[model samples]
Target chain A: MGSFVQWLIESMFLWKALIIIVIFAITLAIAAYSTWGERKVAAYIQDRRGPNRAGWGGLLQPLADAGKMFFKEDFIPAQADKWLFILGPCLSMFTALMSSAVVPFGSSFIIGGKEVFVQAIEINIGILYVFGVVSLGVYGVMIGGWASNNKFSLLGAIRAASQNISYELAMGMSIIAILMMSGTLSVREIVLQQHGGNWNIFYQPLGFLIFTICAFAECNRTPFDLPECETELVGGYHTEYSSMKLGFYLFAEYINMFASSAVTACLFFGGYNYPGMDFVERQLISGFGANAGHNVATLIGIGSMFTKILFGIFFFMWVRWTVPRFRYDQLMNLGWKGLIPLAVGNLIITAVAILSGYKLVGIWVGLALMVILISIVWSLRPKKKNAIMGA
Target chain B: MQNILNLPPIWYTFAILSVLTLFGALGTIMSKNPVHSVIYLIVTFFSISAHYILLNAQFLAAVNIIVYAGAIMVLFLFVIMFLNMKEEADEMKNNKLVTAAIVTALLLGGILIIFLRRAGKEKVDALGFNSQTGMVEILGQSLYGEYLLPFELISVLFLVAMAGAVMLAKREQGERHF
Candidate 1:
């Protein structure tokens, strides 16, 4: 029994399990704080003080909200499909948590003379894994909405399904450009490739733009949040949900926001990779021993990763407050007509650049040509007459 | 008995997944609600994807989930949800159609059993097995290098189908087709 216990303690699986739990807790904590952060950002944007009476600058607001959600009556509609209605939120939360498994939060730490990766699992098909999980996220909204037996909920669910499907095309296309350049799908390899300020965003700016827009649509954030537009669909898919079930749906959104932000940071913003990273590592190694220095550097990388993620989250909130919600037609048009075409164009240009071995210069030249073409088209277009003013 | 007791952990996983796949398939056909059936179908897809993973074909597993369970099943559920299907609608009203279905099922099962029996009798050459063939790099190389023509042709076929769909869905200026 003692030998078995020792083996258990020494096993890599035990450490990996602990790391998974830690990352899971961190994700939930960040998601909780994001709710508070959203309110503060919104309040500041609207020129009002947010919930400051709860704790120091409303630090404890999310906990208070959670408590309120827990204490509230867990209401289920009489006509609702009981099992599916419950499964909806659970599925949503599960998928949201699952997508974060592949994101390399930092570099590896050396413990017991062994390299412990900061990521939960480093699978070769990391990007595809995230996409697969995210695509399943729609079911939560769909099931919840359909099971509610409400017309409004059904509409919201339909909107979500269509929106996710439409945006996912553009998103996949955009990511293809990156994959073509990197020639790998593993998120860690992609991040490592972007070391020392050599980020993919430099080469794939247009792709990044398309990807970020699609990400917004996928997350159902403001400017693309037609699924839950209260003016039209009440609370949308979660209209019939109450108490913790409703809390789960809302918490899932925040978690999705956090996860997507982390992904964006990793994909475009050089996740966990900062300029002078090598220099800092060297300095730390000189100061401390190799293992300790490497561990410290990994911590710094983790800090940099969190900084980028927080900034991405802030950007999400900023856009939410500043941008007006898009009309449903406009949202669909942007996704299908606008972003898809642009993504395809960007992809073609990237392919040409890669083929011709011009790489950086070719991409810039392609961008210039595209800009020139767009300007010429804009100048040559027939002007519309203002029917209302007769101008 | 000794071999069974000392079997590898992967065998246990395979057994569980096989059971799940069968259970999901049964649930899909046996479920009363159309939505429930769709959910069960998704479960079956997931178990199949897991089987692909166990075979070390991670790319196939991911694509299976993304395409079948993620996209296709969502569409299935979407259509089913909007259908307003009554419980009575699930009943087989046509005896002739039911008989045809059963006959076809029996024929397919017989063929599958015959194929399985024949295949099982053949000796396996495990030495030639290359597990690395399923990795992304090797798979990509084979798809693009060896099977490029067929891949491109299939993509072209998909493009044509998409165009046909769009043309069929398009409406004339004055027509109220709906």
Candidate 2:
């Protein structure tokens, strides 16, 4: 076993290819299952038994959905851009799955006497890669809508594009605060930084709040989901899409949502680090020695990371259920008139604090100033004192 | 070549990342609608960030993504979406111009290839670089020490953008109050 593993690594082509294929498969599989889970979640939320007919508590629902979609008649509206119509869902799904490539699921462990990192690809700029992929995420919507040749679909896509672009300000600025404190953007480094209860939540609570809110906006989830408001947009950008193509769009969204949630957890909340994570690592390491046997330890790390991500996803779902969708104007105002300025202020405070010797004071003073300013602005709004002449 | 292969798989991931970026740029142009073009532009900026990561310039990559893809492109997309112009091909009647556009694009590609060919390539040697190098510390040191003026300038630029956005979005100055 040891010899064969060494041989595989040395071969380079074979092992890396195998690794790539495995990661690809796992990512798609996870995405597919999440679709099923989402349906079950929606059903349960709506007080209905969901898809229990398909393979024991609806375990096979995704499969059934896939089958139906594939065999369903695919149609393209005559007025649509045929090529772009085809490209839309493909682009969306591709970008969504590509993001998983850089996420570090676990630390390196010895397998068959060869040390290997658990992540599919350990790009130092993993965080950036995720960002880039996510930015491209909007393309799927844009193309699909444009190709649909429908005014409503196009309007929906336009709204989505604008909303994402707006909220991304707060999102980017907030991450900068984390980047300043953690001093690293690499997810692995971010995770390792939490060796002994150094989770970012303790240090940068405000930034975490900003990121979580923006993540919802970015995912088009909940109150921020004006782009796809069923009452207004009638299925929005995916309105003209049908068959597997439509499934692809929805599937891409859930996967992207899950992945984004994972990223949020990994960055601000300590990716896989838990309360007693170190103790578990120590005991496992002492028992197996990093080289002798360490799969269990790595698995533990992966599980912990997933737990954090699951919590983040649940948070997303909870918000989706709880919050009412915002008006379009309100959404835009939050992004531009609200979050952008706050993010900019946060960036300045973070930069100043990190540079100067007064980190704690910088944060507190910044937050206080912002609050006071907001309150002042709110109160100063010209309230119409109406003693209407109608009497 | 042997030594290069010995580098991690991520070493070649750069090639893939770069290709995705190029695709983004191409996608932008192929998209007739300016809104779609802008979305692709955002993707292009992001892919550039990915390139920064591959080069181990992690800090720059993050900042790049945040500034270009996040802030700048958002503003651009907003403006484009507001305008809502139908896909107008001023060149739609001119079949001759399509060939011109294609030829010019190809020429640009050829020039880039020539530039690449002119540069002598070297083998990978790790050279004191690693995953840890692209973190907050080095980024801060570089930004404050060397890139300080530019950093300050970004604030000015942002202020400019704010003024510009307000002016653009505002109703004509001698008009009715809201």
Candidate 3:
């Protein structure tokens, strides 16, 4: 069996296809289980016993959930756009899967006297591929909302559109800070940029904060889940959907969660890097077995990345349970009135810093500007006496 | 079969693209509804974009999808839903619409066939793009360097569109007062 595996690895085309399939399966499976994890996290946070009955510590809960969703009845409302209703989820799932194509899982390792890379597909516009894919995520919600033949669904879709559009601006702007610091848009390059103790969180702490907040808003997690506000919209855009159709929406959300977490890990948390990673590999592992176990080092890099992603996922769940959901108007107000201006300011600061060669001073100045802006916003708010009188 | 699959990359892509193009254009017209038409148009755009990707004109394809499908189709859907014009009216001259669509389809198909025939005579590119990069850097460099005028013009065009939309949606004060 080991020899067969070795032979399979030696064949390039066969190995490529196998690797692609494995990556797809692993990503999708992680996304699937994240849904169960989210529920368990929420339950634990709320002081309730979680899904312990499915398997040992509810290890098989996600499988049971998938089974339940599959067995449930599928329905198409008489007035719904049947074609679009189908197309919506397909778009969501397709775009959700597309962005992972360019991410480098690990550094290259030697195979058959030649170096072999572990990335799925290396493209020059790696990050732009992500931008494109993320933009397409909007279509799923928009189409699903429009096809539901219900007012609530339409409203939910509209909210999703407006919220996404608003946040994408800030999100893009937040990215400018990273792009300036890293000097490249390639995810692998960005990871390489943070190879040491100099993770981007040190250089661009405010940018990290802004980007993390924007990530929440972009993924439509609480306190930004205005699109799926249960109290007002009655299940929001998926109100009329049942069975796998409903499962598709929920599944897409989880995939989106994973994807966003992956992006966050890549951008702010040094991607697949840890402090002293190279030092440890060079000093200790390089000598072991005449460096024959190089794959082990690569494995460590890959595992570090996945660990960061897992932490990101946990953070998403933690925030979801801890923070109350934003009201619709407040969501809009925060997105447009607050984040947009701040993002634009952040972009200007980043640009000026890059061009002016005032690395430390420029950043501190930017931070001060951000503080002033926030203080101005606070000062502009109505006093309690005036607010009470007006009310 | 293996040899066919292993054909030179350009020709392989070209053959598949031609088939997809034919199917897409055919499906666009043959479809009964505007929704279907738009969806088919998206597929057509995507196939064309893939062809662009093959040719290493990645920028053009990205713009093609972003402008035509992403921006334009959404507006089309908005208008259709707003007007609630989901289906053709029974009282309408169905033959007229059908004939008009058919004639246009035929004319387009004929032109494309002629173009394909001519293109077949030209030297096929067996190699050119070796390293693939996203179009953004290339497009950005070109736009700011050689194509600066056109880039500025596009910005102006966007501004004009914004102004036009505002003007069209605006409530006339004269009418309101009256």
Q: lDDT values of the candidates?
A: 0.92, 0.77, 0.78
Q: lDDT (0-100) at residue A383 of candidate 2?
A: 66
Residue-wise lDDT of candidate 3 within A36-113, one digit each (tens)? 788889999999877899889888999998899999988889998898988777787787787777777777665666
The lowest-lDDT stretch of 10 consecutive residues in candidate 1 chain A is: A382-391
Model 2 iRMS (Å) reads 2.9
Best by lDDT: 1
Candidate 3 local distance difference test against the native: 0.78
TM-score of 2: 0.78
Scoring each candidate complex against the real one, what DockQ results?
A: 0.85, 0.28, 0.25
* TM-score of chain B as predicted in candidate 3: 0.66
For this target, which candidate reaches the highest TM-score against the unseen true structure? 1
Q: Clashing residue pairs in candidate 3, if any?
A: none
Clashing pairs in 2: A183-B136
TM-score of 1: 0.95
lDDT of 2 by residue, B1-178 (tens): 8898798888678778888899999989898778668767877887887787677677688668756765567567656655767857587568899899889999999999987877657444677555665775676777788899999999999999989988997899798876
Residues A248-362, model 1: lDDT tens digits: 9999988999899999888988899999999999999999989999999999999999999999889999999999998887788788888998899899999999999999999
Indicate whether candidate 2 or candidate 3 has the larger DockQ.
2
Candidate 3, superposed: residue stretches over 4 Å from native: A1-11, A373-391, B1-9, B25-32, B66-72, B87-136, B156-178
